[model samples]
Target: MPWKELRPMSQKLEFVEKAIVPGANVSALCRDFGISRQTAHKWLRRYRDQGYLGLVEKSRRPASSPLATAEDVVVSIIELRSKHASWGPQKIAGVLARRLGPEAPSPTTVARVLRRLGKVKRRRPAARIWSVDGRPRIEVKASNDLWTIDFKGWWRALNGDKCEPLTVRDAFSRRVLAVALVPATTAAHVRRVLELLFRKHGLPSAIQSDNGSPFICSRSRGGLTVLSAWLVSLGIRIVRSRPGHPQDNGGHERMHRDLSELQLSPARSRRAQQRQCDRWMLDFNHVRPHDALGGKTPAELYRNSTRRSLSPLLPTYPPEWLTRRANKAGYVRINGDQVFVATALARQLIGLRQESELRWSARFFDVDLGMIEILPIDHAYLGGTVMETVTTVRPSERARERIPVSA
Candidate 1:
């Protein structure tokens, strides 16, 4: 009893034909065809106007959009995007706002326009949660609270020369402090570069790095490499990302990703590549606006640290704490017995505080190495008190037993 859905045009034509005939009652026809009088009249009017084509469904969209982005503004956005293809909508919006004070479109509008023009690629959503197995998160409140250092993965130049640049960034301001194409990735080379940075930017309270060469040694006590040990001697805390997990230092990795995106192709030579990296670092620090920093460039928020780099000296300990100087082989004579500490701690003074009758806590500067347990000598000829084993216990683990948890 309902109007035909598959052939609505045919039904409309039929109704119009019948209604056009003399004395055809439109209201009676509307009742018989189960259509409202208004719909019947509308179809008849459409047929009268354009013979039958006018009865076809037309677009419901308005003929004109007055509130849409102006053509000139869209052209400017496209031009800016063409200039900096890697910039996202948020960054583009920031530029547009600076260029066109009150007339700039919002980031959402820019995203929509870019998506419509096939300029934006959809990215897979990343996981929001990341856990680092009981490690306390370092809170960065100021510019020099933490610094992240890493070597950008090696890529070959057009001439087949390797191009690996060491990158260091301030964690709080996201300012890139250094990007140098070192001769090698050895500890000495990295130490030289860091010394230059320290003298220039002063010193950060802590430096973060991944578990890699020149940064950490898996076999060493506390995973301290020579470079990190030098940093520790300068009174800087060394923070390492979890082994095999790059997300522990996600911000630093994200910066590397941006760098990689910008330098898709290698330069002509290593020197040229170094120059390119230097340019990128300059732009990243001064020009590129960061969304996390509320659309401010890293250079705007960064400040040089007040802690100047000084000559490395032996750390003084409490009068009650016993101290031992590590020999060249990283062995310390404790109660007439030789115990091996880390070679990274070689030629450095270590402080020991007795925690129990047989156990003592070892520390290099402020860093706690672990607890040392003294064992009695089996034979009478050997020394009576012998330091047998050094077991590594994290400060967190030691405090977890005594510290009460709040509900």
Candidate 2:
């Protein structure tokens, strides 16, 4: 919702307070107001602090200052706040409180300390509302509990090709499992990347992504996409960032910013970009110490003691589902549905979780096959072009040949 559409702060606070009463339907009001319950509470917190005055319009600028503070003290706060401008009084206070000990005043004093040094700028309303709280306030337990996945917003390369980074990061370790660059991000490409991750990392307990088509979160389809559906069948839950709230997936977004700032630059060529990305992923997983993790690297955290090495092969699907073997032609017939698979998948069986309706659920190996977009109940296949499908198999046979022909 536009700022013009929302009522004044006083009215919003009043309405939310009234709506928050028992049986008042807070969710409905939140939807109507285009705000979250958290946002509503934030205003409520201000209301409790300064009463109706808090509800009144106020400047982001500080209203008070501290008396006779040491120059070093003020300067230190300045440097810290400069490093993390998004940090609030509470976080800065926590840092100071630990240092100053018995002499630490209130949070207001710390804000004043920052203010006196001129480190704390008057909060910009737009910046305050738009900037995310990326303080690592949440902690991840164990490896692979959650993987934040997203296509890095596009960036231009020196070669003129657009780079859309596909990133999958473990929430627990902050470990970036993959950072793939492609001209375009599509469901098929993303599926291949995810397949590799699954084969290597076992699986995450859940994956969080945006509502974009590639990520596939829509009310009409209930956000079910090939990727999400594949994860779900493996007993992995999927969480979507709230609509219009990009900060809901702050970790992945921050990683994108870091990549742009530190790894890949606009002047780098395609090969250079790939090389830099490869180096960055290596250092990010193994070398860079995470402040939130007490200076530990992501690799130290992504390791799952529960499962050392990932299983060598994909698991077979359950027996109940109708199974059809892909012929040499890479086509399968199941429940009258004709699926044209890549020729490389020949001899591999695809399972269809037969349902009561026309819809069919497909599975491959342990990972549930999400992208089972078979052409027709009987049509051979349709994947961009017939030549495109045929060309993909040549590399796989070469790869097979590269391996020893026999033991």
- Which candidate should be chosen as best, given TM-score against the real structure? 1
Per-residue alpha-carbon lDDT of candidate 1 for residues 371-397, written as tens digits (9 for 90 to 100): 666555433232333223433344443
For all predictions, the C-alpha RMSD in Å is 23.5, 25.4
Tell me how candidate 2 scores on lDDT.
0.64
Expressed as tens digits, the lDDT of each residue in 202-316 for candidate 2 is 7777788777767753421234555565555565766767667878888788888888763334646655676777888998889899998999998886775243343334346
> How far is 406's C-alpha from truth in model 2 (Å)?
51
Please report, in order, the local distance difference test score of every candidate based on alpha carbons. 0.81, 0.64
TM-score of 2: 0.42
How much does candidate 1 score in TM-score? 0.60
Query: Residue 53 CA error for candidate 1 (Å)?
Result: 99
